[model samples]
Target: MMKFRHLRYFVAVAEELNFTHAAERLNMAQPPLSQQTKQMEDDLGTILIERGSRPMRLTRAGGAMLEHATRIW
Candidate 1:
């Protein structure tokens, strides 16, 4: 089962594409934001964001999940 908190974290980061900015928007620290994203990926058994890349992009699964998540919220 996935947590709503994880989903919120993911959506914020996915939209911002920057942990620092996402963290600011989420009103949380960057480390925990990263951790929640990792937890979400671990729960789904797949990679989501491509960290440390210029113009970050989401994996295919991540894109799909974001779509569903958007509809969910």
Candidate 2:
């Protein structure tokens, strides 16, 4: 079950492009933030952030999600 917080967490991570920074911005710990973001991916059945990359990069889907998430936020 996807929730609004999933989008909010993802948006923070996407905007910062860094999990640590995004977690800090969101006033939460990194592990939980990472977990929620991963859960969001699972719920959507699509990769949003390229976790394997250094500094991270948003996938095409991620960019589109960010656009919508930002508007909603």
**Model 1 Cα lDDT, one tens digit per residue, 1-73:** 6899888889998999889999999899999899889989998999999986888888888899899998887
lDDT value, residue 50 of candidate 1: 91
lDDT of each: 0.89, 0.95
Task: For model 1, name the residue pairs that clash.
Answer: none
Q: By TM-score, who's the top model here? A: 2
When summed lDDT is taken over every stretch of 10 residues in candidate 2, the lowest stretch is 7-16
Q: Pick by lDDT: which candidate is best?
A: 2
Instruction: Assess every candidate by TM-score.
Output: 0.94, 0.96
Q: What is the lDDT of residue 2 in candidate 1?
A: 83
